[model samples]
Target: MDKDQQNRITYTVYCINAFAERYRLTAKQAFAYLDRFGGMAFLEDCYEAEHQLSIIDAVNDLTQVCRNQGGKL
Candidate 1:
């Protein structure tokens, strides 16, 4: 993969781990949550918003989106 793709993958993994830890989810469950909510795009947006948004806030946003889509994390 190219560097950008690698970076995205790395960030996705980080987000997956974060979701898992913060929500007491398994890795598989975390991946499902991310995938269902918008996958890498969601993660990238969250990272980009880090300066203006806390990770907890980002996660809360994602959780709400997941719920709106009929999924829970």
Candidate 2:
């Protein structure tokens, strides 16, 4: 993969793991929730800015994004 694509994947996985831990969910569960609730799209569209932030900050942003999209947890 290209460096930019690879970096995006790495950052995305990092965010998923951090999010999972923060929410006490498995990585798979986290992925599903994020994917279903629009968090994945938000992350992709905002990757350049999001990855510059700390993982906690990214997760917080994702949490809000998901909540706005109707995610319960």
Residue pairs clashing in model 2 are none
**Cα shift from native, residue 56, model 2 (Å):** 0.8
Q: What is the C-alpha lDDT of each candidate?
A: 0.68, 0.95
TM-score, cand. 2: 0.97
Candidate 1 per-residue lDDT, tens place, 19-53, comes to 78888999898887777767545567665564256
| Best-performing candidate as measured by TM-score | 2
What's the residue-level lDDT of 27 in candidate 2?
A: 98
Q: Tell me how candidate 1 scores on lDDT.
A: 0.68
TM-score for all predictions?
A: 0.65, 0.97
- Go through the candidates in order and give the clash count of each: 0, 0
- Model 1 misplacement above 4 A: 37-41, 44-54
lDDT of 2 by residue, 1-73 (tens): 8999999999999999999999999999999999999999999999989999988899999999999999998
Question: Clashes in model 1: which pairs?
Answer: none
